[model samples]
Target: MKPGKVKFPATKKGYDAATIKDVLPEGAAPFRRRLNQEVDITCIEEGFYGIICTPHDDMGMVMVVRSGDDHFPG
Candidate 1:
């Protein structure tokens, strides 16, 4: 996909606190959870991106984003 910003909206309780691993693209924005606010990230590279909620990461609150084409063999 083309370079752009991805937005993650926070919930009412504001438990969406997120942070990106160092493997993400160079320009990826640091994520933070704020009540009723949205977090925007700009990924400039084509690869796998990992995101996790600091407060809930241990509970498996995490996600992976894949940019560009999928290279898995069918």
Candidate 2:
């Protein structure tokens, strides 16, 4: 793999990342990897701020939108 390219799973799934153990049942191993990977992926995604698990999108994935909200309250 290249220095920048991460060799994630080559499955049909969009993003292949590792899930953390203990949080999920032993049977649901395929979907679960590590929460850290989600964080990394989320950071790369757009319209992202925070997330709340809902419906089929339980991971709480968010799309970060580049709005004019960068102003800090001084």
Candidate 3:
């Protein structure tokens, strides 16, 4: 993933809200990495089905992918 691929929220509260409520498959550990002053998240799952997100509505990024054909916009 590129730096532009994942852009986290400006505040901790927004970042928390973006990830805390997400429910990934079993054995999938929470992923968090600090990039400079911002902490971005790569919450998308591998395989045919997964999710993609955009930064808006205080949700940071919110996207869903559920097929091999599914596309993630840049």
Predictions in order: lDDT = 0.66, 0.30, 0.38
For model 1, the run of ten residues with the poorest summed lDDT = 65-74
Our model 3 lands, by Cα RMSD against the true structure, at 7.9
Per-residue CA lDDT of model 3 for 3-26, tens digit only, reads 123455555432322333354433
Q: In model 3, which residue pairs have backbone atoms overlapping below 3 Å? A: 50-65, 51-65, 52-63, 52-64, 53-62, 53-63
Error (Å) of candidate 2 at residue 46 is 28
Best by TM-score: 1
Candidate 3 segments whose C-alpha is farther than 4 A from its true place = 1-5, 11-15, 31-37, 47-74
Model 3 TM-score (2 dp): 0.29
Q: How big is the positional error of residue 19 in model 2, measured in Å on the Cα after superposition?
A: 0.7
Q: If the candidates were sorted by their TM-score against the true structure, best first, what order would they fall in?
A: 1, 3, 2
Error of 3 at 61 (Å): 12
Report the C-alpha lDDT of model 1 over 2-67, residue by residue, as the tens digit. Answer: 875667877556366555758464565555656456777766676667777666767998887776
> Residue 20's C-alpha lDDT in candidate 2?
33
Error of 2 at 42 (Å): 19
